[model samples]
Each structure stands twice: as structure tokens, then as C-alpha cells.
Target chain A: MSRETILASIRAALPPGQALPELDNFGLHYDDPIQQFITTAEAVGANLQSVDNRGGIAAAVQAFLPGASSILSHVPEVPCKNFTRDADRDPHAYSDLDLIVVEGLIPVAENAAIWVPDSQYDDHAAMVLTQHQVIIVRASDLVDHMHQAYAKVAAAEVPRFGFFLSGPTKTADIEQSLVLGAQGTRSLLIIMIRDESTSTI
Target chain B: MIDHAQHARNFTANAERTAWHDDALWFVREKRDKATKLIPEWEELREQASQVKMHMLSRLDHYLEEFERNATARGIQVHWAEDADAHNRIVHAILERKGVKNIVKSKSMLTEECHLNPYLAERGMDVIDTDLGERIVQMRNEPPSHLVMPAIHIKKAEIGDLFHEQLGTDAGADDPKYLTEAARQHLRPKYLEADAGITGVNFAIADTGGIVVCTNEGNADLGTSLPPIQIHCMGMEKLLPRLEHLGVFTRLLARSATGQPITTFTSHFHGPKPGGEMHVVIVNNGRSAILAKPEFRRSLSCIRCAACLNTCPIYRRSGGYSYGSVVPGPIGSVLSPAMDLEKYAALPFASTLCGSCTDVCPVKIDLHDQLLAWRKYVVKEGYLDKGKARQMKMAGKLLSSPTLYRTASFLSKGMKLVPRVLLYNKKNKWGMERELPLPAKRRFRDLYRKRPRS
Candidate 1:
């Protein structure tokens, strides 16, 4: 078997063992994580908004993207035209999706990335296929850096699919000119909810 | 024979484009400096990352088995390839069994190394490269010049023309935003219609038996999410011992590659989506051989950030095509020679040994030192050119004897009286693009002997 052959080669080529360094307390940590998160989110071209409660999320989304027509909301606090979760439905049907609103599990302050596991939505394609995205993150769930973020991820049940999304899809392929919305979400809006509450609608 | 100097000469012939390319890459290197400065523990992070890789390399076999076991337990089919041909065949066999015709691939240097696109294309597969830069180069029938910015060599006007011809965009429309939107619209359908999605693994976690792929465009996410079959191709060195190691790499990768805090998306796949199938192909295409060499094995720690390429003066001024390899620049110069010493013997000499690539490397690979090491190996193996060997041999003999060196230094002063034509003739390769400094009126030894005591 090629597997055995490759393993034998790797074993034969092994060098003397070196100790793995301690990773604890080694990475960067921000003084004020929330503010740092806000600053980094904007730097990467993602819009940020703060809401007093979950009830206010829908209004904020409406105010920011009033022109969005085909919206899909995975969060119950924000209702949209499409809320169906049909496993049999083709993921290709979301190519025309204008907006997708899903709740973020954890937010990293250093890079302004939000961890969204598979449990957050029915179809993972909805997050990227849409023209715009609104990820709802709790203000208190913010961490200082990726090291802390991974600690939380490792402690939880491993999802089949999870991602750390920092900003909207972007590219600088042509002449290194920064262009937003290359092959995924063109615009991303992060709505941080400060208080938990039921949907107003 | 691949003469890197000759190819570099052809690239640098266009003085205007060369300057633009140099400035463009330097701008990225500057951004990297600024981004890394924001982290107070940047140096410490680099040290930790280096140690982690060295430790991983020492016990790579144990970790690979652990990763395969965990990945297999999660329902991901793990396959191993002895070389590039075996890798291509494994992927093709999977597609053939599934009757897959259309495929979408994101940025995968491994696939490029294996030349998988052409292999599948010859079998009548409609393979589409989804990354915007990759797509542009794919349409042009060209290889990526730089790893991070594949189409960096092509100007915006050229891209506008390419889009106009291939995707029916309006001619003379060179705005990056407009061109990028055209690509987004054009590729959305391909993602939807693709029978399989193929992506490159950024990091494979042994602890979780999952793979992490980072992308600025989220092309990998969309490409894999929509398709029923997803194939991830990874070089064996991509493995990490645990999940937390990702934090160390993710923090360094984007900040090093394009100066972002992180890529737009860092997607982790532990297993196939419900009712879907996933396969992981572990390739050993010349990597185990690299591991066998203790002096050069540290080069395996490269995270493909391309920081070394951006900082390399030779890579910036001469352009990536000069190296004539899948990867170009300082890291490529060291790695290519290992593949074939005869073919890539000229690569090590392409550098100025500036050590800037070493200073900026996140994993702390001694890139310039490796280049210097490769030069010795090349000479020892008798690959060094005869003319250069003769010149070095004479220089060695002169420097060994004090009387001969002093006498030669004294005679060199009379050469200044010679005409410019005599000094700058075809036989003087060093004088081709340079001028000799005026020889000192008196030898340094003579001047030192006449100096007053302090």
C-alpha cells in the first residue's frame, strides 16, 4: 500500500525529536476586546452595528440594507421572507439569495472573526452564496484572540462544518487592486446584541 | 537546461513593468510589517510556530497515522500517494467511479504541483478554477507567477481584455471592482453545477481529524458546500499535532501573505456534509525526500504565506517567471534544487543573499543560509559552470598566498589606465552591467602601516 510505503519513508527520514513549545499566554491580547473587534471589523471592510437587544436586530438590518429583497434569516429574533430548512432542497437554489442573517457563536477581537458552526444554519452555502450577510454576535461572547477562540471551539462538540469569517468575500487579484465581493458575500454587517430578548414581531 | 538567469533577463527586459512589479510587491511587504507590528508578541509567536513545526517533523509518521485514523473515524476517506502521478490517478479514479464530469477547484498549489487540471481535462472533465486570480490565469492558459497573487504579473488592462474575451465583459473596462463582479457572476453558476469540489488543505488537525482551508474569497466554502462530493488535496507536511496550533498559524498566515489580520474565511471540515462524501489525498511528492535532508528539512515548515517571495529582492525585480518553478522566489530557490540539482542548479545563485527573506519568515526558515548551502552542494556535485569554477579556483589560489595577493592588488592599479573598451569587453561578465570601483592609490596594508599610533 502506498500508505505503508509513505509511512515507512517518513519514519526513515525522521530527525531527532524536538520539544513542542508552550502555547499558553503566548499570543496577543487586547485591552478592550469589544472596541478592538469593532476597529478590526471596519478595517477589513465589514460594517458594524450595536443593538440594545435582540428585538432591535431586524430594524437595524432593515435600516442598513433596506433594498434587500430575498432575505433568509436563521435567527428567530430576525424574521425574513425565507425561513424554511428543507434538507432535500438543492443548495444551488440559494444562488439568488440577497441576504442571510445567522447568529455567530464566538467573536475574536484581534481579527474581528466570528465562529459559525454547522448548527447555526441549515445550509452552509447560504453564508457565502448570498449577496450580503448579517451575523449576529453577542457582545459578551467576544474573545481577545484566536488562541482563546480555539479554546472555546475545542471544548465544544466538533461540528462537521465550521468557519471563522472575518469580513465579506474580497480579492486583490487584478493589479493588486482591493475588490470586495469576489466570489462570496460582497457586504457583511455584524450586529452585536447587548441584551437577550424575544423577537418584537 | 533551465537557465534562471536567462529567463530573468527576459523578464527584466521590460524596465517599466519590472519597476511596477517591484513597487507592487514592496508595498505588500510594507503592509506585512505594519500588520505584524500591531502584535506585541509577534517574535514569540514565530518562535512557537517554528518549534511546533520542528517537533511535528520529528514525529511526522506518528502524527500522520493519528490524523488518518481520526479522519477515517469521521467518515473521511483518506488515501496516500507515493508521487504526483499516483495523486492524480487517485483523484481521477474517485471521479470516474462517481461519474463526475464537471468540477470546481479553489486555490491548491498541490494540485498545480501534480498538474491535475490538465490530467482531468484530458479525460474530458470540465474543470473550473474558482479563485478569481486562478481563474484569470486558467483562462489565459498560464501558470500562476506568484503563489498568493497568481495574476499579479498581468496588468488590469490585460485582465479587462481577458474578461471581455472570455466572460463577455465590455472592452476597456479595467476597474478591479467591475471585473471582480463579473467573475463572481460568472462563477456562481459553475459552483451550483459542479459535480465535485476540490480544494487545498491549509492545515490538517490530528487531534480533531479535520482540515482547515483559509481563503479571502470564500471560494472554497461555496465550492465545497454546494457539491455532493468534496475532495481535499494536501501535502503531508500540512499536518499539525493539535487544533490549537491553528491559532498560531492563522494569526501568522494572512498577516504574512496579504497583510490581513486573517483571511475572510477559515473553514474547518471534520467530515463530509450529511449524505455527501469527502476524500482526503495525502501526497508525498518529493516531500519525504526533503525531510531526509537535515539541513534542508526546515524548509518544510513553510505555511505558503509567500512573505519570503515578497521580500526577496531578486524575486521582486526579476519577476516570478525567472525561477521557472510552480513556486517562485527565495523558498522556491531552496526547494527546487532538491527536486533536481542539475535542472535547478542556477536557482541558488539567483539570490543576492540579502537575508531579508530570512528576517521576515514567520516560521524562521534560514532561507538565505539554505541558498548558500545549496550553492556548495551544487559545486560539490560538479553542477557549477566551468567558467565560474575556473574563476573561483584562481581566486582561491591568490587569496591563499599573501605575496601573490599583494602583488596582484598592486598590479590592479595599473589597469585603471586601460581604455573602457578593454575593461568592458565581452570577456568581462562582471563588467557587463557594472563598473569597477577606482583601485585605491595605495594598498590598505601600506596605508595601515603608515598610520600613527592612537
Candidate 2:
């Protein structure tokens, strides 16, 4: 078989195996991870909002994204007519969506990336097809760096598909000039709920 | 094979374009330095990344097998290709079996190496490159100038002309945002209509049997998410032992490439989405030959960050097309010779032996040292030009014997008194671009002998 032949060639060429390096605390630690998260996220061209409680989230969304014609969110507090979880629908149907809000399971401080499990999202296409994406996470959920973020994912059975999204889709392909929206969400809004009681409520 | 010096001469003829190219790449290098400076453990991370690659290459067969088994169990069809020909044929067979006509592709340097686009197009398949930069160069029918920034050599004005002719934009619309938007409009329907999507894998996790594809634009996601059939091609060296290893690579990749903390989309695909069918092709393509050489084995550690390309002085001045290979700059100078020494013999000579590439490498590949090694090997293989070899031989003989060296020095001094036309003839190539310095009337040895006691 071709597989056997390729593997044999690889085996023949290999030198003695070396031990894998430890990947623990591989970078600087932050005194306040949330502050670092906000600074890093903003640096990458993401807008942020700290909602006092879950009740104010919808109002904050209205205030932030007033131009959104259509809004879709799985969050119970925020009202949306077009929910992503509606069953037996084509994924491409979400292509015209103006806004889609989802909850972030974990946040990393070093880069303002949110860990969104595939299971939580009704369709992964929602994250990419929309004009703008809003990810809501508790301020306390932010970790110091990628190492800690991976520890959280490795501790449990990670979903079949997940991603660490930092900001809106962007490209520098034209002339190496950074452009915010290029085929994906134009803007990323992070609503970090500081009140612990409203994180789950 | 084309001579690198001749090819570079064509690129450097336009002094303004060369300066633009140099400044553009240097700007990326500065951004990389700034991004890396923020992390205190940047050096430690590079060391760790290097070790990970070395360890993986040592047990490559084992990890590939583990990854194959796990990926197969997850219902992803895994195929193996011994070389570029086999890789192209395998992808063709897959598309033929599925009766797919239109193919949408993201930025996969592997596909470029295999020349998959022309191969499929010859078979009456429409292959559309979805990445904006890739699309621009594809329309022009030219290979990518740089790995990360494909159209770096082409100016915005040229792109505006290309887009104007191809996409029917304004006669001279050169704005990056406007050009990008025009491309987005042009490519959206292609994405929805593509029968299959092919992507290059950034990292293949053995433990999870999944592949990670990172892109600044969400084109890869759109290409894979909407299509019914997805094909991913990756070099065997892209494997990692576990998913956690992704954390380390992810942190290092974007920061080193374009100075972003992370790419906009770091999508991880464990298997085909919903009802789609996914296939992963693992290509050897001379990678095993690299692994066999102990001295040059560290070249396998490259993560395709192109940090070396951004920082290389020779690459900046000469432009990427100067090197007669798809991959250019310092890393390509080291790698291309390993593949075809005769064809790429001039690449090793293209560098200034500056250590800037090594300093900025995320994997610590010792790029400059490898480049120097390639120079020695290429010369030993008798691939050097005959005239240059004769000159070196004569210079060697003259330097080894003191009597001959003194005679040559004395003769050279006398030649300065001769007419400039006699010495600055066509036989003397060095005098073409520069003037020869005047020789002193007194020899250093005679002057020292006659000097008064200090």
C-alpha cells in the first residue's frame, strides 16, 4: 500500500526520538486578566461593552449596534426574532444575517480570543456569515494566556469542533493594508458581564 | 533552470519598485519585532516550538499512523502520496470519483507546490482561489511572490488595472478596501457554487484526529462550511502529538507572520461537517529526503511564518521572483537546494549571510547557518559556474605560495600605470559597475623595511 511505503520511508529517515518539551506557564502572567483582555481585544480592532447585569444586555446591544437590521441571538435575555437554533434549515440561509450573538465559554487575556464550542453554536456558519458577531462572557472567565485556556479545554471532553476567535474577520491581501471586514463579520463586540449573578442568569 | 542573478537583475532593474518591495517587507518585519517584544517568553517559546518539531520529526511515522488511525475512525478518508505527482493524481481521483466540476480553494502552499490548479484545469475543472491575494495573482497567471503576502510584488496600481479588466471595477480604483470588496462580491457566488473545497492544514492533531486551518479572511471556512465535499492537503511535517500543542503554535504563528495576535479564524475541523465528506492527503514530496540528512534536518521545523522572508536583506532588495523557486528568501535558499541542487545552486549565494533571519525565526531553524552549509555543498557538487570556479582556483593557488603572492602584488601595482582602457575591457567584469582603486607606488613590505625604529 502507498501508506505503508510512505510510512516506511519516514521510519527509515528518522533519527532517534527526543522527549517532548513541557508547555507550562510559557509566557508572562497578568495581574488583571480582564483588563489585559480588554486592552488586547481593543488593540486588534474589537469593540467591548461591560453590561452591569443580564437585564441590560439587550439595551446595550441596541445602543451599540443600532444599524443592525436583523438580530439573531441564542441568549435568552436578548430578544431576537431569528434564532440560529431553528431546526431543519439550510446553513446558507444564515448568510444574510446582520448580527448574531453567542455566549463565549472561555476568554484568553494574551489575545482577546473567545473559546466557542461547536455544540453551543447551532451552526458554525453563523459565526462567519454574519455582518457582526457579539460574544458574551463573564469577566471572571478570562484567563491569563493560551496555556491556561488550553488547560481548560483539555480538562474536559471538548466538542467535535471549536475555535479561538479573536476579532472580526479581516484581511490585508490587497496591499497589506488592514481592512476590518472581508467576507466574515465586519465587527466583533464583546459584552463582558461583570456581575457574577447575571453571568448565567 | 534559470540563473538567479539574471532573474534578480530583471526585478532590480526597476529601482522604484524594488524600493517599494523592500520597504513593504521591512514594515512587516518591524511589526513582527513589536508583536514578539510583548511576550517576555518569546525566546523560550521559539525553543519549545523547535523541540516540538524535532521530536515530531524523529517519530514522524508513529504520529502519522496515530493520526491516520484516529482520523479514519472519525470517518475522514486519509490518503498518502509519495510525491507531488501522486498528490495531484490522488486529488484528481477524488474529484473524479465524486463527479465534482467546480473547486474552490483557500491558500494552500502545498497545492501550489503540486501545481494542482493547472492540473485540475486541464481536466476541465474550474479551480478558483478564494483568498483575495491568491485570486489577484491567479488572474494574472503568476505564482505568488511571497508565501504569506502573495501579491507583495504587484503594486496597488497594477492590481487596480487587473481588477478593472477582470472584475469590471472602476478604471483606476486602487483602494485596498474597495478592491477587497470588489473581490468579495466576485467570489461569494463561487463559494456557494463550488462542488468541493480544498484547504491546507496548519496543524494536524494526532490525539483528536482533526486539522486546524487558520486564515485572516473566513474564506476557508466559507469554502468548507458550504461545500458538500472538502479536501485538505498537508505536508507530513505539520503533525502534532496532541491538541494542546496547538496552543503553542497558535500563539507563535500570527505574531510571527503578520504581527497579529491570532488569525481572525482559527477553525478546527475534527471531521466533515454534518453530511459532508472530508478527505486529508498527507504528502511526502521530498520531505523524507530532508529528514534523512542529520545536518540539514532542522529545515523541517519551519512553520511557514515567512519571518525569514520579511527580514532577509537580499530578499527585500532582489524581490521574491528573483529566486527561481516558488518558496523564496532565506528558508527557500536552504530548502530548494536540498530538493534540486543544480537548479537552485545560485540560491545559496543569494544571501548576505546576515543572521537577522535566524534571530526572527519562530522555530529557531538556524536559517543563516543552513544557507552557508548549502553554499559549501553546492560548490562541492560542482554546480558552481566554471568561470567563478577557475577564478577561485587561481586565487587559491596564488594565496598559498608566498613567492607567487608577492609577484602578483608587484605586478598588480605596475598595471595601475597602464591606460584605463586596457584594464577596464570587457574581460574584466568587476570594472563594469565600479572603478578600480589606484595602487600605491611603494610596496608595504619595502616601506616597512625602510621605516625608522618606533
Candidate 3:
């Protein structure tokens, strides 16, 4: 077979979705970093010190969450692992906390905002924001953020999608009327966590 | 069809476009440097971003399944499409069910991958591009040459002329603000009258079934907020593991893309509006196949920030249309081959292997390396012109063996016939536009041997 046809056949065979199969799913469900933080943070419910990756909201809760709670946070970055690590490939490579504000407890940006996790791989390494002052936001805020994002992308161009998701940029290119959110990412959520160590300040 | 062969011709032939391409990309490179150089921790951040994408890609299946379950629980319908046709059919079928012919849309590359707007238009629905730059290119019936700045290839006066012809602007009005206002006024009616809104997802959080989009223009708010039905198209690779990582990305994205401290607006989403219907389409296209290749997986880490486009020397010269896809520049080179290698056979070779693009890329994709990899693929695919193939094989054979190489080098010492027809004539793409170098009468190897034996 022609190499072109062979490659296309292989491309055709692969399944499409959000994540690759078999790499992360052993069908084994376990509490990852976010899950563990969620379990521990909710147990304390007020001011609590976290081991790592759980400070942005722990501090926010101490400051606001209905109770007079104290502050505690951990230095999120630990010692490096035993691999050949380079920080150049992926910058947002750090493992971070999942933050949430049930009653809009933390003020991040002007609106409710949640921190996004970073990526890591062979080409790029992650940049862990050490002891970062993270934001905690409401679930509702994520919805609002998505709606706005949807509109921005809908109006964008398709070819420019590589440049920042251009297909979402809504334009009257097909017709002479203005449209919104044609690209369709609906909301954003920001979770704030405060490790008790940072809260000590 | 993109009519890629023909469009590619238009892109390379336009000298003005070439100049605009250079200046436009240079401006992007400058912006990327401003973003990356600012943080002493910038290199570290790129690594983090790449690793995060890799991990997300690694666990992509689980996260997508998790997302589908959660999104469905939250009343959002999730659909899987393996290709552009499937994605378009699903979206069109959904819109047909709603009986909505007029729809407002934000930017979405997936739809472009599916050619969704045109597909819908063929069905008689009206789709509007909400972003100002998108609107400009859409109106001109031209593909955007650059990713971030859509009309970066278009001069403001040309836009004025286009608006004057299409939108009825006053004959000498060339003001950016004035023209912008005209477009806004012209498009406001669609936002209100449209029945559904379409958008593209910048980042999809599988953990929480959420999305994040950042924009300088506030058009996204106008597109989705004023519409009742919303559909979001997300490339499967656009997944993130957590929300905390957003802080790192938002800090780096706009600064790298356009030199802004941050995009004027960055929004996140979890579900539908209180009363609206929400649909999410996850598209694979060639992503799964791409992920399987260890060398090529890093291409998926692209944040769609177009920083590399700005720094690419060849891209500045040939422009985006030469690549013949919606996504252009360095990312486009990596992506196009995955989608359809034969069609984009020329794209990988378009680069000069300058590597400046890789240096400026925010996520630090080894773009030049990818381009080099593509060259091998094209040759192996048998897509290269036979004459070129023959020449390459002959050269390879000659160089790989010292005797053949020495014989060829000896033969070329006094040979004037080779240069006149082989490399310096109209038949060669390189010689078509630039001056062909005159071949030296004596070979450098022969002259060095004749010198002293030091």
C-alpha cells in the first residue's frame, strides 16, 4: 500500500475523544490530588492546614466561610523526582489544588474564577507556582465563564483556531447579521484554596 | 474543499500579502518574547504546560468519559464525532431539531475542521461570526492569514473599502474605531434575532465538565448571552485536569499571544444558562492517531496562541493560506499532516528550518523538528514529485558512499551544464522568484586538496 494511504488508514482507525484510551484509565477509579484535597478540606470545613496543593481556598475559608476559622497552608512544591526533568517543555507543569467557594466565599478577579491545572509531557515540563495565592470561586461562575468563552470562540475564525480557538469568534461572515457564541464553550469556574501555612501570615 | 492547490497559489503570489505576512508574524514573535521573557520562570512554565497536556492526553479517555457522565448529569448532551463530517452532521441535526435557521456563533476551529458554517449555510441557515477580526475575513471571503489577528494581513483602508462596499460606510472613513462601530451596529441585530449560539472551547475541564475561553474583544458575551440555544465544539485534546492550572495558563496566554498582561476578558463555563439548552461536541478528527505517535503528541499541547506564527520566517513570507487549512503557521504544519498528509505535502517543506518559531512558542513545541519529520513522511509517502524523488535518492546514494560522492564531486569540478538547468531555472520553485546562485568553476573539495597538507 502507498504510505499515504497507510497513514490515512491508521488515522482513520484511531478513536476520537477528550483523552487517549488505555493510558490513564485502568478503569481504576481512585482519589487523585483534587479528590483527596476535596475530602480533606470539606472535613475541616473551616481553617485548615494542607500538606500540599490545597491552600488557595483553605485560606479563603479561614478568612470568610461563615465561621471564625484559623489559617494554615503548605508549601505546594516538594523535592524533584528521579526522572530527567526539564522545565522548558511545559511551563504550567505543577500539580495544583482544586478550589471551590460554596457561598462565593473567595474573591478572585472581579468575578468568580477557578484556577486551571497545567500540563506536563516529554516536550515540555511544568512550572509549579510555589505557594501561589490561588483563587476560590463558585460553580455558578464556571457556567457564566463558559457562556462568555463560547461567544468569543464562536465569533472567531476556523483557521485561526490554532491561534486561540478562533472558531468561537462569532462573526457575520456567512451573513450580514451579528451572532454570538457560535463556537460554544459555555462557562468557567475558579476554585480558591489556601494552604494553612500561607494562612499563618 | 479548501481548493488548497489553487489557494496556495494565491497566497504565494501575493507580494503584498508576503510583506504583510512577514510584518504580521514578526509582530506576533515580538509579543511572544514579551510574554516568555518577563517571567524568570517562563521556561519552567512551558514545561509544566507541556507535561500537563501530556498527562491529560495520557488519561484523555477516562477524563472524557468522566466529562460525558458529569455533563449529561448536569443536563448537557455530549456527542462524539470522529471526523468533520460526523461532527457537522451531529450539529446540523441538532439545529434542525430546534428548527433554528438563524444562529449566532463565536470562534470554533472544530467547526472549521468540519466546515460547519458552510454546511449549515448550504442547508439555508444564517450563521454570523461575532469576533471583529473574524467578521472582517468572513466578509472579504478570504481565509485569515494569521490566527490571533485575523485581519493582520488586511490593511485598515482595505477594511474600510470592504465595509463601504458591504456595510455602506462613508467614502473616506478609515478610522479603526469608526469602522469597528459600524460593524458592531451592523451585527447587533443578529445577536438579538438568532435562535441559537455556537462557540468553540478553549479548554475543557474533564474533572468538573467545565470550559475556559479568553478573548480581548467582548463579542463572546454578545453571542451566547443573547441567544437561547448554545452548542460548543471542543477538540478532544482541549482538556485540562484541574482548575488550579488555569492561573498558570491565563498568566502566560495573552502575554505570549499579543503582549497583553492578560486577555481583556477570560471566561469559564460549567453548564448551560438557567433556561437555555446546552450541547457539547467532542471531536477527535486525527487527534487520537496523532497522540499515538510519541514524537507528534507534543503538537497537541498547543494553546492555539499563534506565538510561533509570529516568529516563523517562512510563514511570514508565504502567509497562512499557503498552508491551506483553517489553522495556520507552525501549529498548522504539525496538524495538517495528521488530518490529510497528501494534501498538505508542501506545507512541511515550506519552512527553512530556522527554528526561531520553536524558540518563541509559549508551549515550546519543537515546530522545526516536526517540520523536518514531515519531510521524511512526505518522501516515504510517495507524495513527492518523482523527479524530486529521483534527485533526492541519487544525492543520498552519492553522499552515503564515499566513492560515488568523490566521483560526483570530481565530475562537477568543471561542469557548467548542471547548474543552468538543474537548480537555477524556471522549473525550480526556489529559482522562480529569487536569484539563483552562480555555480563556482572549481569544486571547494578539489581546491582544499591542492592546498598544503597541513
Candidate 4:
């Protein structure tokens, strides 16, 4: 009954429809998108690292967070001693995780955001519950803007959920002071793999 | 009647705090300017975003139905609420059926509008606000001042005292990083223990049957991901026609909000996670009435970026609490009066009609024009105070009659000879905080008559 009432009211309030604007030329592009991505990513407080292949991710992770004790790695290239993917396990089980390494699908150069779908991991909480996060994105998978990134997302298989993660969990709530790791991941590291053949990682 | 001027006077009484607040907001506005400058197509993007919103408003019914169908097909439960009470009841009913005890909420202004936390708390449900700023305010038992930076009104030292009292932090520990870490430690358990998660919708895509929530702290994701049940409360106006529109809105949102390239997490939820339940509560709550008024309809297009609040000179100086509403800026001034004309009639007069808010609005809502329109409606509806109404009527008559205006102008030149006490007495409201300008040596009419003809 409320549904019908709301819909009727909306219809009654409707005015003559206007045309939606074309978004063909809405987004901006840089001459060097990767360089722009690095600059923007660092500005947002994300650490950037260049890895040659999937094998180098382990070394890079160790170098980035040497003291990480409890690790959760969704990427098979980077094995962890702490925990493995368990679909039925309670998400709270990953609450004490020190680091989480997952693969990013597409990286947007404009905002330095990496698209990570739910299908990439068994538990969604692992992405944000950890102290530090490492997202492995291919250099070739970088797009110029969100428009291009969304195009890729629209074309891909629809996940139940996904996100364009730009940086670590941060907040400027108290006196507009930028504080990283406010309620979630304390730090974010993007490992850009330049080797094209290492896609399966 | 809600006296905004009196409340503003209370806030401005502390001159030092007022200047600090003004400088803080101006700093954010400058950051916004710098961020937007990076994109060469920024103005065009705003135009495209505004047109898209207008188009969506025109066919709102069609899109709402489309969104409901697509979302329901994806196994997300869809519910509609005719008003705020209905919204609170629907959410409570869902949580009640699930036997949820403890709940965590992200920064959803709709819930704040509905007073959902108190409603649920009265029924013995424990509701925790998970956003750091929101948590701080919740602890202090206050409402958010600004939309984006909720705790911007409270200084670091106050927060330090609050944390020391609530979370047992060291005394005099006023560093933002330390206070934020204390909040992080305190809220993580709430997220882990929450039986349900409630979040506000940033944008809902009709074509994709999903909603996008943007946050820097990722609390929304954490709260919703672990909970067995998740509820997303959204105003009907948040609907977008397609997923591509997100590309446009997401680009403009953070740049306009906090001057970030983007919020850290732009999470998209198509439906519930595996073995988890998700519900979308679409609440009307005076929005349909707003849509019916062509003059005020564009106010519904706001994305809650708080750019208008940051750029508004009055908001900067007077602070958000002075507005006496859930939202407290130029957009709030226009929207609040429409909710209750008699109670909020004074809100429209709170601004200087500077139009800075209009220039910075991502959706290009004519905020100052709407304020002016609301003032006309307020006067026509006889909501203005009796004394002000009589003075305005007298001024109107004098301005319409050239002879009366000229006579008054001529007589007013003699006011310089009068003592300041007689001129700035209780009858002169304008002279309360301002000085009357000195009269010209000769009348403007005489000077114009003697001017050399070009």
C-alpha cells in the first residue's frame, strides 16, 4: 500500500521529461595516464611499488610490511601463513588480520582507484579489516578515467558487490585533520605488475 | 517561531571561535577549488551532472519502478515508506524479525532525519554510529554540524576531553591522529559485534539495480560486510537512470566534498552477499511534496557534498548549529522552510543572497534564487513578524511614491545633527551591529540636475 501511494505521488508530481545530457566528452584524460595515476595515488596517501611479475609480489609485500604477522592473501602468487579463504567462515574471523593482499581488476588513472570485485575474495571484510592492504594491478589494465573504468566494469561479469578503492581508510573528521587508518585499513599499497604474461596471479 | 538570528547571535558571541570556524570552512573551499582546477572539463561535467539530475526528476516514477524491479530481481528486498515513521518502522520490523540486538550505522542523513536511532533504542536496540565524526557526536549526544565534516564544529581539545571521558584516553591528549586512533579502536568492536548494518545511499542506479556508497574510512563496507542483515535507507531523489551516470557523479562528489580526487572507497552493492540479507528502504517523507513545487524542486538534486556549506559566507561565520535543522547551509535554508513553513520561515532570511553557493553547486541548483523565492512565499503566507511586516509595507509605499521618497531622503540629511543615542535607539534594528551611512552634502536629485551633459 505504501509502495503504491509513493509511486502515485511521484507520478502526480512528475513534470514534462527533460533530455539526459550526453556524457561522451565529460571525462578528462592525461598525456601520461600512468604518471598521473602515481601522482594522484601518492597524494591520497597510497604507496606505489612497481613489480616485474607475480613472483615479485611476495618480496614487495615483505618489504612494504615486514612485521605483518597475520596475513590473508587471496592471490595465489603471494602465499600467507595466517589464513586461507573460507566462504562459510564468519567475517569476524579476519578482524585481527595484519595484512591482506588481493588482486585489483582495473586501475583508474584519473583518481588512482583500483576496482576490486567481491568475486575476487571469499570474504569482503578481509579487504578493510586488515591493518595494511596490498592490491596487485597490472600496468596494462590501467585506464584513463572512471568513464573508461566503468565501461570495463559494465562489460565484465556482474559481481554481487564491488568497489573502486583509492587509498587506505582515512578520515578528516576531527578539526579537518587528515588521519589515515581511521576505522579500517591503516595503509594501502598498490603493486603495479608490468609483465603482461603474469595475469593469472 | 524558529529565530535563526538569535541562534546565530549566540554562535557569533564567541568572536574567536567564529573566526576559526570561518577559516576552517574557507580552507576546505580553497581545497575544492584546487582539486577542481585539475580537471579541464570541470564546468562541463557540472552541467552534464545537472542536466542528468533534471532528466531523472522529470521521469522519477519510471526510474524508481525500474530500480525496484531490477533490485528485487537481484534478490534485494525493496520496501517503500510514505513518511519518516514508516521508514523507521520498516527498518525496525526487518531487524526485529531477524532478532538483531546490536546494530552499526554509517553516515546516513535519512536515518538522522527519521530519528531512527532513538526509535530503535526505545525498543531496546543498541545502535552505534560507526563513522568517527558521527561516533564523536553520538557520544556527545549531538547532531552533525556539517554534512561531510560532521565534527568540524568541535575542536581537537574538546575531542580529547571527550575521548578521555568516554574511551579512557590520556588527559590533555588532543592530537587528531591520537583521537582518531582511539575512535578506530573503539568502533572496530562495534562493527564486529553488530547484528545488522544500516547505511545511507549515495547514488542508486536504476539500470544496474545497485547502490553506490562513497566513504573515505570504509566503515560502511565493514559494518555491512560482517553483518547478517544490511539496510540501505535512501531518499527517492538519489536515483540515477543508469550506471554510466556514476562516472559523472563520482568524479564530482569527492572533488566537491573534501577536495579529494575520490573518496577512498566507492562501494557498489548490487544485492546481498551470499547467505546475507540486504534491504533498500525508499522513503518519500516530504520529497514528493518538494517535487510538486517547480520553484523548489531543484533542491532535491543536492548530492550532500557540503560544498555549498563550505562556500557560504553566512554558514562559515554563523556555524551549522545556528540553522536549527538537520542540514544547515544554503541548501538547508531552502529545503527546511518547505518542510515546515511557519517553523522555518526565518531560515530564508538567514543568507545575504550572495549566490556563492549557487556557483559552487555541482548540480547547479539556484540556491540564492530559491531562498529569495521562499522569502516571497513566507511574506505572502504572513509568516514574517508583525513589526517587520509593517516596516516592509511602509518602506514599499514610500519607494513607490517619488514625492514621499524624496521628502524622506531630504529630511534624513538632518540626522547627522542628531545625537547617536537618539538615532541608534531600540527602534533601529539595522543599526544594532552596523552604522548608518553619512548623508551626502547635497541631494542626489540636485547633483544630477546640475551635472554637465555628456
Candidate 1 segments exceeding 4 Å error:
A195-201
List the DockQ of the predictions in order: 0.89, 0.77, 0.03, 0.86
Candidates 2 and 4, the one with greater TM-score: 4
Which candidate, 2 or 4, would have the higher DockQ against the true structure?
4
What is residue B348's positional error in candidate 3, in angstroms?
1.5
**Model 2: CA > 4 A from native:** A82-84, B402-454
Residue A120 accuracy (lDDT) in model 1: 87
Question: Cα lDDT for residue B223, model 2?
Answer: 87
Worst 10 residues of 2 chain B by lDDT: B425-434
Query: Which ten-residue region of model 4 chain B has the weakest summed lDDT?
Result: B423-432
RMSD (Å) per prediction: 1.7, 2.5, 14.7, 1.4
Residues B107-156 of candidate 1 have per-residue lDDT tens digits of 99999989999999999998999999999999999998998999989999
Candidate 3, after superposition: displacement of residue A17 in Å?
A: 17
TM-score of each: 0.98, 0.95, 0.68, 0.98
- For every model in order, the fraction of real contacts preserved is 0.92, 0.74, 0.01, 0.88
What DockQ does candidate 3 have relative to the true complex?
A: 0.03
In the order shown, the chain A TM-scores of the predictions are 0.93, 0.94, 0.20, 0.95
Estimate, for each residue in A1-201, the C-alpha lDDT of model 2 and write its tens digit: 778888888888998889998876754689888898999899888899987878778987888788888888878877775544674568778778899888998899999988988766688777787789888888878888887888888787856678888888888877688888888888899999988864573
True-structure lDDT of candidate 4: 0.91
* Top candidate when judged by DockQ against the true structure: 1
